[model samples]
Target: MVLKIGDARSMYRKFKPHLLMVLIQLGYTFLNFITEASFNEGLNPYVYITYRHAVSGFVMLPFAYFLERRIRPKLTWPLFVELFILSLLGVGFTLNAYFASLRYTSPTVVASMVNVISSLTFIIAIPLGMEKLDLKNPRGMAKVIGTLASLAGVTLMTLYKGKSFRSIWSAPIHMGSSSIHENWLKGSILGVASCITWSMWYVMQAYTLERYPAQLSLTTWMSLIGGAQSAVFTVCVEHKPAAWIIGFNIKLWSILYGGIVCSGLIIFIQLWCTKEKGPVFVTMFNPLSTIMVAILAYFVLGEGLYMGSILGGIIIIIGLYLVLWGKENDEEEVPMRSS
Candidate 1:
């Protein structure tokens, strides 16, 4: 009985990160839907993102200071430089592009396209020597095939917008400008760019995490630096002071949710997951968010669900499973090979 209990504990420990990531992605799905709705209400994307990072930075700073006070390593210039680059890729540019894409496309579209990050991360990892791809190995082959399948799904979703299945329920609040129509092509490109930058961020995070093991401190730094960087862009683009104002409206709600949940909470959870599992492991769960977004967007926002999206989502799921299976197999082999 003791042996069996130990085995169960071991299994749980191994799978915990994966489970946590799935839950995080689900939370992110809802967050993304709300953010898209906010964007539609005339909220300037740059201003919104700037506030998000600032809030996230402030929230994280205290926790980082308190929780990681003792164990925090000495701040070095090289680390500072890395954090700056991470801020640019992970928070500033990535989110700015992401919110801008939402202005052009639906939340579901952005979520679906973002799944390409998993594939992109996997590919980039190989070149960085962070991931090994041996064609002869079944696991490696599965990874490659899964990456291709996900990319294909992204392509289908971008190219084909079949008949719309709009929901009966209307959004409770419609506040923003409705001037922007859906430009699938431009949105898709920007979405793809966001994915790439995000993937790069993941890779860099994994690399940096090896040296700086303090997750909270790292996240705090990233948020603070990224917020400052984003502020510059916001000031340049949104010259009016009125754009930054957050009253008791959807805009306020959006910034609070984004700053607290998306940036503050989500970044910590992701950093923890990445520390436990590699960046690829964390990324592979992105497709789950796509499905979540599709459902939430359909019901809450009354967004149209197209046939192509359905089919593409299905393909992405299959690919996601393939990659996960491959990773599992690879991990199982590690102990055996070592022994």
Candidate 2:
């Protein structure tokens, strides 16, 4: 069957956000392994965040300047202030807490924590009036129920390790630690805190994107501001010069990848996606990343594939389905800009 140009364009545009989010999840899933490895190699979390923001901001500056030079809005005082707060919430404080959590916890645990971001975001978005969760509406029920199911599944996945599976990995690359119980408690607290900040970031980013429609420029400005904020904090606290050093090692690579791909590109893509599909829509995919990480751990690191994992995966998928149903009911309404 021959397809018309207009039809193909429509199909591409329709599916683009889904494809983009899948790629984002894959990037983050692999990043979990890489960042954890770098942490193990003694890369300090605060220093890592400082460098990460610096790299992303500097790297994306040129692209934003070139592509958005004409369309970028004037940096008004209110807008500047809002963006500054966003930089603080989204980048500086958020990432510092996140990497610190990652330093204490394994990637799988971190990924599991990510499952709650959607629920938290949904709750926040509702009070902000971004989401209309009328229990009367079937759509609202779908979202609410989906979020609860996903959260339950994540709890089960993390808490219940039913059985041990044989090693599917060929190489003996030992990375995970079993004696992380104490650290896990600490990391879980940090992870939950990061999720809360991250959820706030999502809701705030959606609101900010309205007045500042230029995604690339917005990302660049936020990165620069956030990077500066982190750098200042790191300078005050991190006294050792050696901790700040960027040697030819995993530290350098983690900063580059986390900065360029995860931060720069991913943030821009997320901003674009959040613009297209509301903040809650963007966060609903966090569970997918958790599932990917679990599967990867089994095959790559020889981690056990437990019954809870499989059952949790099924529940998570069903939750995603319900959320997708809810998304269909969401009215695509951008917030009116306030004067």
Q: How many clashes in each candidate?
A: 2, 0
Displacement of residue 186 (Cα, Å) in model 1 is 4.4
Model 2: per-residue Cα lDDT over 76-129, one tens digit each: 899999999999988888888887788787888889998899999999998888
Model 1 per-residue lDDT tens digits across residues 166-282: 877786644355667468678778888998999999999998888888888888888888889888988988878878777788888999898988888888989998877789989
Report the C-alpha displacement of residue 323, candidate 1, in angstroms: 0.7
Per-model lDDT: 0.83, 0.86
> Following a full C-alpha superposition, what root-mean-square deviation does model 1 have from the true structure?
2.5
The global Cα lDDT (0 to 1) of model 1 is 0.83
Top-TM-score candidate index: 2
Minimal lDDT window, size 10, model 1: 172-181
